[model samples]
Target: MRTFTVEIEKDEKFYIAQCVEHSNCFTQGKTIEEAIHNIKEVIDLILHIKRPKLHIILKDSLVNAL
Candidate 1:
């Protein structure tokens, strides 16, 4: 599993979570725990799927290229 940095910011009533490596990846929740959980799930979904920008290799479809 790859490691990612999660930054949390409080905005009045919600906690916003953002990935340091990905500017477009962000989410918000009512609490710190909820924000963390939301961000975790978001990261998983982002990493597991193909991205148009980076063309990231799908985690579930990786293959040996040797």
Candidate 2:
């Protein structure tokens, strides 16, 4: 598992959560708990998308080597 830094701040009416490593990764919620939950969901989604590509790359490399 990989670790990332999350930064949380309040803006007007919502708490915004952002990943320090990924500028484009961010989410907002009414409370800190909600914001954290939402950010986890977002990170899961990102990893879901990236995981498949990584698997594909590894598969291709192994196939090429064989």
Candidate 3:
């Protein structure tokens, strides 16, 4: 089993979670926890069906500089 890190972002309306190591896999929910859970489900589905090897670019800065 492989471990993937998921990055989550929340706005006023919804939360979006995406895997840092996988592109084209993402999920949205009403809250952070929900988003994380939904993203996990998406990951499982993708892995089970397609088993794709996703390569994502690493970003050094997570926040914008003001």
Candidate 4:
């Protein structure tokens, strides 16, 4: 698992959440909790779609064989 930093701030009507590691990733919600949840979902989606190039090994077996 990887960890990323998230910064949240309140605008005029919504709470905005942005990933410090990924400037292009951000989301907004009516409440701080909602904003955090939305940002988490967004990060998951972004990471899932743009997976890192690193490889994983388990019991000398390579996952994501490619």
Query: Which structure among the candidates has the greatest TM-score?
Result: 4
Backbone atom clashes (below 3 Å) for every candidate? 0, 0, 0, 0
Q: Give per-model TM-scores.
A: 0.67, 0.68, 0.67, 0.70
| Lowest summed lDDT window (length 10), candidate 3 | 57-66
Worst 10 residues of 2 by lDDT: 50-59
TM-score of 2: 0.68
Q: What tens digits encode model 2's per-residue C-alpha lDDT throughout 1-66?
A: 566677777767887877777778789889767977777778778755332111111123323545
lDDT of 2: 0.64
Clashes of 4: 0
Query: How big is the positional error of residue 39 in model 1, measured in Å on the Cα after superposition?
Result: 0.5
**Cα lDDT tens digits for candidate 3, 1-66:** 466777766556877778877788888899666876677688879866334333332233323311
Per-residue accuracy of model 4 over 1-66 as CA lDDT, tens digit each: 566777776668887777877898789899767977787778778876332221211221212222
Candidate 2 wrong stretches, greater than 4 Å: 49-66
Residue pairs with colliding backbones in model 1 are none
What residue pairs clash in candidate 2, if any at all?
Answer: none
lDDT ranking of the models: 4, 3, 2, 1
Residue-level lDDT tens digits of model 1 in 1-66: 356676776767887878778877778889767877777777768766332222222122112311
lDDT of 2 at 52: 19
lDDT of 2 at 30: 96
